[model samples]
Target: MFSRQIIPAVAAIGCVLCAALSGVAASAQTSETPYWASISVSKVYMRVGPSMNYPIEWVYQREGLPVKVLRVNEGWRYVEDPDGMRGWMAARMLARTRAAIVIGEGAAEIKGEGNASAPLRWRVEPGVVGELGECTDSWCEFSVGGHHGFIEAERLWGDGEP
Candidate 1:
């Protein structure tokens, strides 16, 4: 009689434990973060503390580099730069400028600089985000869409730029 009763009790405890575990798992999944966001302004500064009075330690410049937002506290946020530099800054310096990456490594080729024979184009360093532009195989032009020259597709980020 004791064995029979204990078996059901053990099974009941197992079921309760499984249900508790599942609930915890669900909560964890729902609490994820949108920490990584694209910089939309020409340049935003990451400060040392959390205000303007603080020194500017780094910047997420170039209008489109992706930044990892560590956390938002008070009116400021702690962020990590692409180069792994971390700092805090007031929230007003950020804007809606669109940014993108060169994808792989090295510089992208900028074409049409000279006669079409420059078909090989020229290369631009990666990690720089510029406005998207027209491109052909091995050639693309970029600027901040206007600031710089027509860097090659291999070095830009856009519909075909990348």
Candidate 2:
């Protein structure tokens, strides 16, 4: 009787220990990783310093600009912009949305369709955001402000197989 009672008690304790260890391991997986995220919250505050009481430096005008998350600690993440500016911003101010850019020395033509020879619907100023879409070797489809079009692959950021 004593031996049988000891076996059941030990098994129950073993089960509790396993459960606790697994819970700790699962929480470790929930931590942050480096990736590009965006600004979803309206009026995301960029800090003059890292804490909440710090003065506002700039208000994010666009809702979705791609940002590289450098480090997350407590309530803030250090980030670097596409243009390579580094600053500390509140984690709540950022969101997981993707955005794109137009690169090169000349203007990007927004066509009515996804062909170079397609009719031009509008012209996007370099560094302006267009609705992102699929692509080929030399071009990626895009849209903006109710217009869908294609621009050269070299003229876009976050495009063509990223």
- The candidate maximizing TM-score is 2
User: What's the residue-level lDDT of 69 in candidate 1?
Assistant: 60
The sequence of per-residue lDDT tens digits that candidate 2 reaches over residues 5-102 is 99999999999999999898665434566656666665676776679888877666766666677776666767776577777788777865555677
TM-score of 1: 0.44
- Model 2 stretches with alpha carbons more than 4 Å out: 1-34, 48-50, 53-57, 112-115, 160-162
| Separate clash counts for every candidate | 14, 0
> In candidate 2, what residue range of length 10 has the lowest lDDT sum?
27-36
Regions more than 4 Å wrong, model 1: 1-34, 59-61, 95-98, 108-124, 130-162
Clashing pairs in 2: none
lDDT (0 to 1) per candidate: 0.59, 0.71
Q: Candidate 2, overall lDDT?
A: 0.71
- Model 1 per-residue lDDT at 23: 94
Q: How many backbone clashes does candidate 1 have?
A: 14
